[model samples]
Target: IGGGSTHAWCQVYLPGAGWVEFDPTNGIIGNRDLIRVAVARDPNQAIPLSGTYAGSPDDDLGMKVQVNVICEAVAGDSMGASAS
Candidate 1:
């Protein structure tokens, strides 16, 4: 909500804990139901085919996204969020 991109996530490293990811935007405390494409030391690091906008200070930009999550039917599985 501050600038550039709309979402962000980070991981932390503890001595014996290795690396753990946390997504503050979705209140997700772990890497469950997520994918790790690439890791960066700095959030500003450039991603392949990624770009930035150069616009007037007063100009506004916007985007909209829709997400639909479906769970696969696994044997003896009935523990998760159900879409309604």
Candidate 2:
């Protein structure tokens, strides 16, 4: 997630509609770009420090999330283009 962000948002429960999810970041109705790597009962249960850690949890650790999409095609490259 290079320029992307990681957040924990709650889902609203409607009486007749059941559970509905709304993304406040993009202002969309459903989960389109949302990447669900892990799932839990609540956000509190989710957010456990992952990624690279040196020595121990108390020691210096580095975490990185990269979200890169090949937006354009290169002249000689064959990777292809990506869409948003």
Report the number of the highest-TM-score candidate: 2
- Supply candidate 2's per-residue lDDT for 25: 62
Per-residue lDDT for 1-84 in model 1, tens only?
432345568887867988888777666776875554456877666353456889998897766544566658787877684877
Give lDDT tens digits, candidate 2, residues 1-69.
221567654568879988877767666455666765557896666875546445865764445766565
Taking all chains together, the TM-score of candidate 2 against the true structure is: 0.42
C-alpha local distance difference test of each model:
0.65, 0.62
Error of 2 at 74 (Å): 40
lDDT at residue 42 of model 1 (Cα atoms) = 75
Misplaced by over 4 Å in model 2 are 1-3, 48-63, 66-84
Question: What local lDDT score does residue 48 receive in model 2, on the 0 to 100 scale?
Answer: 53
- Model 1, TM vs. native: 0.40
